[model samples]
Target: MSFKINFDSENVSTGEFQLVAEGKYEASIINAEAKEWQGQFSIGFDVEIRSDVEQKHQGAKVLYNTLYLSSTNPEYAENTEKKRNSFLVACGYSGKQSLDLDEVVKNIIGKSVLVYIKHVEDKNDKERKYPRVSFVAESKVNPPQPSGPPITVGSDDLPF
Candidate 1:
C-alpha cells in the first residue's frame, strides 16, 4: 500500500550525544537481559540516570554493566562472582537466604542504586569516550514517605 505523506526536513535537528558526567548519581535499572558472547553467559544492564539529579542531562541512559557468568581463568572467574554478589547485595539481596541468579536479576529491575560513572577513552579511538559504571551500591536516598490527614480531637470527646 502507498499513501501520500507530508514531511519537513528543515525543522529536524540532531544533537551530539553527551556522556554522563563522571560522578556518583542515583540511577535505576531500566532493563536486565541475559546475553551470550563467545560461549560466555552474562547479563547486561541498562541504567538510566535520574532526571532530578541534573536538569540539563534529562536522565541519560547508558550501558551500565555486563556481568559474566563464566570465565576460564580462575582469578577472573572469582572476580566475576564477586561483582555479581556485590550487585545483588546492593539490590537488597541478603546473605541469610539461598541465592538464585535468575530470580535476583529479575527482582532487581527498577531498583535504585548509587552508580559511580567514569569516562574511558575508546581503545581504538582515543578521541572517543564512553561512560562506564565503575561502582554501585545501595542508594542512601530514601523513598518518599506517604502523608495522611492530620488527626484532630473534638472538645466533647475529651473526658474530664
Candidate 2:
C-alpha cells in the first residue's frame, strides 16, 4: 500500500505587522513526503503551533480564515524497495493580517493545532491497501529563550 503526507507550512508563529495594501494571503506547503506499507499497521503524527504576540506585541489584532490542504501529486514509485515503513509530518506558518497581534494571539497563542487525516484508495487497485490514521493536538509551553549577557557587580565579567 502507498500513502502520501503533506502540510500547509513547516513552521508557524503569531506576531504583529502593518499591512500597507489589501491582498489575498495564502499558506504554502513547506514540505511533503510519502511512505508505503507492506504489512498490516497504522501511522500517526502530532501537530502544534506557538505564538509570541502576548510577550512581544500586546493588544495586537489579527484575522485568519480556514486552513486548507490538497493532493496535487500522486505518482507511484516503480521500485518496491523504495517504500517506507511509516510517515511523520509537521508544519507551521508566519505572516500578518489586518487585526493587531493581540487579537489573534489568544486564538493561536499557546495552543495546540490539530490536523485531520483521511485515507484515499484507488478503486481500480483493490489489491493495494492503506492504513487508517488520526490526529491529536496537545498544548505545550513555549520554548526557552536565549539569555544574553548578564550584568553584575564588581568587574564586567561575561555571563552566560
Candidate 3:
C-alpha cells in the first residue's frame, strides 16, 4: 500500500486572493455556441484564461457566461438587454447597434483584454467568495506610456 500525490503542485493554484485585486491578464476566447433554453436562444462564451492570471484562476480555461438578446424573450426584455450589453462591452465592443451571434464571436474570439476582478459571496450559508469581472478594457499592444516631464527641444537634438 502506498500514498502519493502524483501531480505537480507548482502548476496548481489554491485560488485564494484578495477581493477587487486589479490585474492585467491576457485571455483567449476558446469557443462560442448557441443553446436554446426556456424557448429562447443564448450565445455562450467559453474563454480561456492566459498568461499570469492563469495561476490565479487555477489553470482554468474560461469564465463562462451567456449573452441573451431582447428579441429572444419579450418577458425578459430588460434582463436580456442588460446581459447582452454588458457582455458586448466587456468583449471590447463599442458599437451602439446590436450584432448577431457570428459577429459577436468574430470580434471576441482570439482577442485579449484587461480586466478587473471583484469578489462576491453567495447568499448561502457558506458565502463563498467568487471572482467576478467588474471592468474590461482592450489589450494594449504598444509599449507602456512614457514617464517624466515633457521635453521641448529643438530639431538639432535629433541624430538624423
Candidate 4:
C-alpha cells in the first residue's frame, strides 16, 4: 500500500527572512570510526532559519532584539541513532554593526525572517529518503555591562 503525508500549507511560507541562510552546512561519512567501510557512506544537507522581532521601548530608546534560529528541519528526536547524523545548522547575521544605536534601531523595525532547510540521504549510492525538518527558536542574549574594574578601598579610608 502507498501512503502519503501532507504538510500544512498555511503554516509554511516561502517568503523573505523565512530562512536566514540556505545551502549545505555539513557532510560526513556515517560510522567514520568503523574500519573497512571508511568513506563508504555520507549524508548531505541544507539549512534555514526563522527569525522574528519584537519592539521594546525603554524611555526614548528602542531596542530591537531579534530571535534567532526560530526553527529547523528533520525534526530532532530523543533516543534515535539518527540524531547523531545531524549537524548544527543555523542562520543569523554576523560581524559588528558599524552604525550607531539610532541607525541600528531604524534598520531592525518591522522585519520578519524565516529559514528553510533540507537533508538529502543516500544509501548504496542511491537516494533513499527525505524527511521534513523543523526547529524551535532558541535565543541567547549578551550579558549586561559592568562598571569599571574592581576597586580595593584602603583600610585608612575606612570610617570608624
TM-score of each model, paired residue for residue: 0.69, 0.18, 0.46, 0.16
lDDT, model 2: 0.28
Give the local distance difference test score of model 4: 0.28
Candidate 3 collision pairs: none
- The sequence of per-residue lDDT tens digits that candidate 2 reaches over residues 1-160 is 9998776685655664443122111112122222224532221122222233133222222222122121223453322112211111122223332433233323333333322333335479976433222332221333435479875676556473
What C-alpha lDDT do the candidate models reach, one value each?
0.76, 0.28, 0.59, 0.28
What are the per-residue Cα lDDT tens digits for candidate 3 across 13-110?
A: 78875443335545556676766777777777655555444346533553555555546447878766776676667577786774676676666766
- Candidate 3 differs from the real structure by a C-alpha RMSD in angstroms, to one decimal, of 11.9
Q: Write the per-residue lDDT of candidate 1 for residues 46-67, one digit (tens) a residue.
A: 7888765543355788784776
Candidate 4 per-residue lDDT, tens place, 1-160, comes to: 9999998878876663222122321211111111112333222222222111222111111111122211232352341223321222111224443433333334332222221224345556564533223221112322123479988899898997
Off by more than 4 A, model 2: 1-90, 96-113, 131-160
The parts of candidate 3 lying over 4 Å away from their true place are 1-26, 52-55, 71-76, 114-160
Instruction: Write the candidate numbers in order of decreasing lDDT.
Output: 1, 3, 2, 4
Q: Which candidate, 2 or 4, would have the higher lDDT against the true structure?
A: 2
Q: Order the candidate numbers by TM-score, best to worst.
A: 1, 3, 2, 4
Using TM-score, give the best candidate's number.
1
